[model samples]
Target: HMSFVAHSGTSAVGTKVDVHRSPTACNIPVVARRNHQSCSIVPALRYCIRNERSPKAPSARPAQDVTTSLAENLRALGADPQVILDHPDLRAADAELLTSSLSALSDWVPRRSLGALLERHPPLLTAPLGAWADFLASFGFQRLAIQELFLNSPDVITSSSVYRAGQVFLFLRQLGLRNEEIVGPIFRWRALLVEEADYQSAASFLASEGGVPDELLPRVASTYPGLLAAPVEGELRPRLQFLKGLGPEASRLLRGFLWEDWCGWIHGLANWSTAVAPKLVALEDLLPGGRPAAEALLREVPEALKCPPESRLVPNLRLLTGRMGIQGESLFVLLCGAPAILSLPPEQLESRWVFLLEAANGSKADLLAYPPYLLASLSKVTGPRFFYITLRGLTSRFMNRAFNGGDAVASESGRRGREVGAGFGIAGSNEYNLDLRWLCEGSDDEWLKRMALEQRAGPGGGGWSAAPLALVVGMAGEARTASHGQEGAKELAGQQQPQWQEAGLVKEELLLLRGDYDEVLSEWDSLLGWCCDKAFTERGCKRFEEQLSLFYLLIQGRM
Candidate 1:
């Protein structure tokens, strides 16, 4: 009999085995006991015995035992044994234990929502309270919470840095906290108080009732008087005067609010001065009497001037200038100094400001011509008689109508006139007339004479002229030699002279006439190449060639 045994060492009796005898014969044994056998079983028994004696064999176990065995196998493989047991497909108890263990280690906790926390720690709520407040703000707390905190913790609100203050202001604005509501917090914290006798009792009652002080009420009402009935001038003015009496620091704070409110009111008015003139005058009265306050008010003038119609700017300018006195130079400077204002139409200009065309040195002609340009030139004229003389010369050029008309018409003239006009026109524009022949020859002659004198007088006479002349002569000689050989070669080869070379020569002559020797030499090289080309007339070429040689010798003698 051949048998398979369970690893638990249980029955080989229930084992089933296959037996093979020869090629044609086979038998299967459903074994009940270990003893019964047949001939075919004998060979199979030997085979099974050999396999069992060898290292490999199949083992059997019950289904429950098999799963337990698999679980153990998985545990040995570093897998969670309970993972298999708790698997949805596994209807097993082992996996529940594994899940429970993991849950225990994770230590999950539940959190109270923001609404519940605020309900518990009510005092914690406030605007402008740094990082914690920012975090709370994200949760959208009620406005009452913000107001309550702001009222109780005024130091917390005011002591905040600028960034924090800005954020708090933005938050309060978003919450629709009115100026009255803001004043309630301020007065509650002693940031403000009523100046009047009965007003203190009224303010105490108002504070208890969570309202703005009665005296503050009138002032606020006056500032935004359109919200109320007819202006309570006498009653409100004193309170405003009291707020203004608060020292510079308090004044600064008051001004920030007043200015903002005033600007808002002004912006809403169709005509600011007509609608808010009294308010503006009141604001002026409220401002501190000093240079600092004057500067503050003056700073606003430019923005007021910007894009205002002539009708509006004129009155504003008058009002500012009259009140600010000499310190109001800003308004005058902007009105007179800005380039854009100068471009305004004559009617607008006349309507906006008085145009005073005053001439420097009592010259009416200078005032009438290029007044703005002249004024600009005069401003740059510093401590010197020479500057005034230069200005006079410049003014004279500008005042001359003939020169201007000639300049304007020169380009439109006939060819001969164009050439003459171009020359004279350039000279006139540059404020100097140049003689081309005189410049070319006269400079060379002067230089040669100076060189001859220097050589005779020795090095003590100054050898500075020699270096510059030597450079010029060497450059000129190079040009001449280059021209001669190149022209002959081009003639021998039957090539045409280059157009650019001709242009260069003309440019050289112009530069030489202008006494620009460096530029002249640069262009002369090109001219020499053109003259050397055989395609050009020999006589013309010889003339230029001779001039170059003579010029070179003259320069060399100077050196």
Candidate 2:
């Protein structure tokens, strides 16, 4: 019979029994009855049976045996037992046995030290913390695992401090971490500071490191203005203050380096007279206001011009004149051949007059060859055109010497004497013929004739020279007025035609005049187009064209 009992608590206990029937038959084995009682009695029976241990289930093999079995199994699979064990998940006891078995298998068993592992595989130090942290935890080395992870895995540590601490807990203290290695991740963490508008963090980084990244200088310069404006007294302030102390030269150098968008920074300083005023004062002191400074400045100009190499002569001229005192006569003299200055009438003071002359009886070659400076000086005293005529005479003398191998001055004197005699109406009244022969002496007759015909046609067939003729006649009248009064000059001009007819040189003079007029008109048109295109597009009309038109009109009126 089996008995069962029940227990409530320490102080209360109860017992009960109940019997179960067993089936029996003839020739059948007798069955024992089960006695039901309190549940406490059933547990006691169970404990007794358990202690009885029917077969003493085979004693568990030693942990070493299990490890050995695993090692052998791994070896049969052609894997190193120690490697299988070290793979993080294996039991500690199994790992030990596997390690031992590997040592036995070969004399070159790899040491399982963390230092050796890290040295062999530096990338392991840079692995994520969670991966290695779980690994150490499996090995029952949680605290040491955290430490090892932090010290070895700087990339992971820098990414998260909590992860780093967890790593430290696993790895137990970093074995041989270098300061640079530790700071490397932290430094990168603070790189964001460089981009910050305050720049304090970036400046601090630079100050600590002796030099910042070369790429950051431009950013600093660009952000410096705003940063300087900020009231923060930090690393950025000192660095910026140092930069400001460098003055203009440093600013210019910085601009040269960071070529991108530097012009805006410069333009901002256009109103910054506080900074610029001192420099201007210094410049004034250096240059002063006299010819000495002007001369020195001019001396330096050639070199400056050479340095840039692309600057034009016109702007250089302007700057040169601006730097020196603008004495009207000198400026005009320097600008003699430059017709561009003529358009600047407002700039042309009364002291700066330019005269055009008709070298009526003088040589054209002599006029062109005379030194420009001499012509300029002469223009100051004599009428401009008269000076030109005198220059023409001098040029004629030179050409006469060069081409004729004789004195042109003496030749001019003889011509003048002939003209005087012809003018009196005593030399057959053939002044026109005489004048034509003298002017056409060296030139091609055919070309001269063609020019005369074109001039008679007038420029573009537009009579524009009428006004100039009136002006010229009036001037001539004025000149003769002192001798014969307006009436006599009027008569001289008016009688030109009758005189030509009486001298029987009308056709010849007209032909010669036509050719000369055509040549002059064509040349004037060409010169007008060139000057207008090159130098005076801003002017409303072409000066030479206007002058040519006027000249043609005057010739037509005379005809």
Candidate 3:
């Protein structure tokens, strides 16, 4: 039912190794092997030599005998038989020239890695050694340094296209790294030496758009070598324009967007602009600070460009506005303070909203003053540990009623609120008080310690409640009452009088209130198990146990 196989390939040291495949059942899909003969220099040479000696006469001799004859002929040419055996290409090569070439290169490359160098760059055998040595010397590399560079990157000495290599060297010099400075970067990424028009285009664009001076271009290229490969029109220009539109601050941030593959960059940028940008612009009105504040949002958090707007940003906003009933300028104020809330996946945002609205019975205004609540992982930190302090009865003294008209009004309100609290608004000594900024950004240990301190301080505002249980009952009644026009909200509001004690409900009922738990749970379980099982069996190695362990951890969280 199962079998193991070995595949052969030449390794880094020029040694042949067999890589084994895992055992699997007959039902498993099998890759078709290609039918092709491998080229052998020894056999080909023997055929040529025998045919030349006797055109029509038949000559029957064993393959070993032919190999012995070939070895004897190469030995007569004053070449090392072992070197020829190691570098098989030398069998058909100019044997006399190969001997001189190896001796010339003996001082530069080590005896052990010489075979590796020749194997990687066999063209070096035919190419003039004098030209390569002269090229290295012309570049001002000392004999010792040349040996080191060749050892590190053998391609510097053995490149077939010396003209192309020279073009790359000239390009880097133009970038501003002169003499010895170019050696480090060139040796690290040999691809930088390959002359391409795109490298010039990218450098020109950065100088023009980024205001990078001509002499300073090398600094940027050395810091981010990938820019040398970016497509001028498709990738470099579009990303620059996108960042520039944000404002001066955001435009300045563009310099930090390190160079990566131009193709991937364009694909991601196009996806973000077409899908994510519209949602960000749409949410601008939701920010309490309005236009100026919205511009600042992009400047502060450029990573929002990578998130899927429809899947992540939209769903998170919906949970706050649609489900939690936090509407208008209040939502804007909340998001402006902590933009990272938008980065959380929609489902994670939904779970946190469920905790805040239902379990805590938190007011919409409280969320505005403290937005970090949105970023908290509900099932992990908020639900199990921090739930008691934020329960229904707690009065949110930290909540600030600042949004009167717009920016000026909110600014004045914040100033007055800070004065009233005596520098104790969010991060105040109050048991429930937490600086949204600190709580959201801090490590897990810090968050846990803060939560533990809050627990020790005793309940501050109010007592516990199970009001989250009422969301299901409220949804059903509200759907029916929607037939009425303006009265629909009034009907829904009047029906929301039931508290945790007033309405008896169980934990299981509350969880299944909004969605079909059975279908969601089953689908998630099947998908995870299938993926993990496939990875584990296909790898068939003890090294993959960590991946299997991580799958178990995720599976536990879902359940």
lDDT winner among the candidates? Answer: 3
Q: Candidate 1: give its CA RMSD in angstroms.
A: 37.6
lDDT of 2: 0.32
**lDDT tens digits, residues 156-219, model 3?**
4454333444445556765677555654323433555444446777778777775666766776
After superposing candidate 1, which stretches have Cα over 4 Å from the reference?
Answer: 1-271, 274-377, 381-396, 405-559
Report RMSD (Å) for each prediction in the order shown: 37.6, 32.3, 23.8
Q: What are the lDDT figures for the candidates, one per model?
A: 0.30, 0.32, 0.46
lDDT, candidate 1, at 479: 47
What local lDDT score does residue 63 receive in model 2, on the 0 to 100 scale? 67
Better of 1 and 3 by lDDT: 3
Q: Against the hidden reference, what TM-scores do the models get?
A: 0.18, 0.17, 0.36
Task: Assess the local accuracy of residue 524 in candidate 1 as a C-alpha lDDT between 0 and 100.
Answer: 41
Best candidate per TM-score, number?
Answer: 3
Error (Å) of candidate 1 at residue 227 is 7.5
Question: Per-residue lDDT for 172 in model 1?
Answer: 32
Residue-wise C-alpha lDDT for candidate 1, range 187-229, written one tens digit per residue: 2312211112233333233223323443455444324322222
Q: Which runs of model 2 end up more than 4 angstroms from their true locations? A: 1-515, 523-559
